[model samples]
Target: MISMRHVVFMNVAEELSFSKASQLLFISQPAISKHIQLLEEQYQTKLFERKGLHIELTTAGKLLYERLQAVKEIEHKTEFDISVLHDAIQAKGNLKLGASTTVALYILPKVLSTFHSQYQQIDISVLNRNSESVKEALLAKQINLGIIEENSKVNQIQYTPFITDKVIAVCSSKSKLLKKKNYSIQDLPHLPIALREVGSGTLAVLKRALAKHKINFAQLNVKVRLGGTEALKNFLLESDSLGFLPKISIAKELKAGELKEVFIDGLALQRQFFFIERKGETSDLNKGFIKMAKSIYNL
Candidate 1:
């Protein structure tokens, strides 16, 4: 097992604050300070220099931080490998999961249900949030694993393709644009548009697609920006404005004629969902869950 002091030091090194590290490690500030003090005393090296209210890692601290990352990676991998073998011998335990809005709503439920039925003893907890928030939760160690749209370029996270889905323009049947099967990007300026909030995976995907077409997102003429899929769906159902959403999200509504999907000529908006985790190694539960999910999803 890794030393508690080393773990605390790495957390503090990553966060650069005693308070944030404490919150992350579920320890108090004084406890965090004591652990850091112990590590520094044992090594006889200063780890951090105080800069105003901020703490900056010294050269020796940076070296130890890098070494700790490698050590933790090895430790995690060994433990996971053992767990994998143990699970193969007897599969039992709990799995904690996190997913972006689209995956939670349209993709994971059925898969999770099937996994539960097969492995009746394996408990599952799924935390739902937007992609960016899900990533943050994973980074904070609040979740063991996460599925999200590919929006991050952070080197510390690993992204593996989970599945592909499309985002389409949807509106109430009462929308003036309902009569058209295809509309140009230029025509979107005339319609009242509903959009997802900033930092949302859906919004990020949409922005990237629009940028490829040389369209400025600021010129989209949005009527409102909603916080979640449910909110955006409700607003679209009650208004004539159009909104972009994952196809899987409104499958039932579209079939029921409550919403209509619109397309743009020469513009294809497809986003790939990815399984993400902190870069380095994965545990047995993490590997198992991802493999099982992909098999179930036919990915």
Candidate 2:
């Protein structure tokens, strides 16, 4: 087991802010400093250094953070294995899940509902972020499992195909863009479009699909960039620009005639969602939660 001082240090190292760590661990800033001071005294070296307005990890701090991450992973795995060894159904533990905007908003709600119904004893927490941020959170050991729309084979992580999603171009049903009878990829550069912010899976997938036809993202007239899927969807509702969004997100809007999906010739915007994790993570709780998520989608 890791020491309390080390736990405090780890939180500080991850957050890179003493006050932030204090807030997260529900301790006062001075107490947080005391723990770090004790750790530095024990180690005979400085773990962090102050630079003007902020702090950064020293070389020794980096080493300790990396080793402690491994220790924490092992500790979590062992505890879960022992706790759930006799009865998984009644096991009490925590599952931290990280998902991108689309998965968090659309895919995981039903999955979470069903999982909670069976494993009521287990507690679950979810962090919603863009695809890239989700991957960073996994690397930081902030979450045990993640579901993202990006299919990139990032190193040190494993991806399991979860569900298939499609990105469809859309505009408000009453917009002038809908006045056109037919659309093609060639017309995209001339159209004003709203895109998701950088690091979003939807934006990444859209760029790749557009690239196949010798079209670059800069060529399109992007009117606005929104951070979340729902934000972009809602923005498109009030704007005249075209936007690409996950089919699942706008299904209700499409059916209600609030938004109209524009079909472009030879452009297929299909994408695969994946359940991702650290390559060697072996928590049964993680596996069981993933199993439940996949089962709900029948994939």
Candidate 3:
């Protein structure tokens, strides 16, 4: 077991701010200092030094932090092994998951709700970001596992196909663009449009689809770019602008006559979501959640 003092020191080292570490640990700043002091005394080496108003990890701190990361991997492996010795539903531990906006807002909740009903002792937290951010978070060790719409093919990470998805161009049901039964991809430059921001997997897939016909993404008459799916979806509802969104995101809106899907000749935007983790990792918590998600969605 790791010492509380060491935990405090590691948190402070990771954050480089006592105040931030205190807030993260729900302890006072002075108590954070006391723990760090104890840890430094135990090692007889200063773990941190002030580089300004902010603190920076000293060489000793860096070494200790790297070592602690190794220890953490071992600890999690031990916990995972021990937990599997019993029935999985009876196990107790924390799970951290990162997912892109579509999965977090739509796909994940159903799985989480059902998983929690069976394993009430397990604590769960989710980080919602775009697919690229989710990938970066998993690589940074900020999340134990990630569900992403983009598979970057990085060698250090393993990807398992979760589900297939498609992005369709859509606009408000009342928009004038609907006057035409079907629009060609060539007409996109004339249509006012909203778009998801760069680094978004939705945008990435759309870009690839556009490139198939030798079209450049920059040629579109994009009026605005939003950072999230809901933002772009809402923007389309209020303004009669065209935008591409995941089919899963706007299903209800499409059914309710609030939005209408626009067909583009020869432009197909489709992608597959993947469950990603560190290479060679076989944590039971990660497997259990993946299995649960697949089962919940009947995939």
| True-structure RMSD, every candidate | 4.5, 2.2, 1.7
Instruction: Highest lDDT: give the candidate number.
Output: 2
lDDT tens digits, residue span 1-299, model 1? 67999989989998999999999999899999999999999999999999998999999999998788666656655654665566653455556688988899889988888777766655578899988888888876666679999875678788888999889889998887787878898887777899998878889988888888888888888999998998999999999888999988999999999999887787778888999888865666678778888898777
Off by over 4 Å in 3: 26-28
Look at candidate 3 and give me any clashing residue pairs: none
What order do you get sorting by lDDT, best first?
2, 3, 1
TM-score: model 1 vs. ground truth: 0.72
TM-score of 3: 0.94
- lDDT by residue for model 2 over 183-271, one digit each (tens)? 89999999999999999999988889889899988999988899999999999999999999999999999999999988788888988
How accurate locally, in lDDT, is each candidate?
0.84, 0.89, 0.88
lDDT of 3 by residue, 83-196 (tens): 767766667777889999999997888999999999887779999999888888888777889999973688989998999988999999989889998989888889999999
Please list the residue runs of candidate 2 whose C-alpha ends up more than 4 Å from where it truly belongs after superposition.
15-34, 52-54
Cα shift from native, residue 80, model 1 (Å): 7.1
- Deviation of model 3 at 255, angstroms: 0.6
Query: Number of clashing residue pairs in every model?
Result: 0, 0, 0
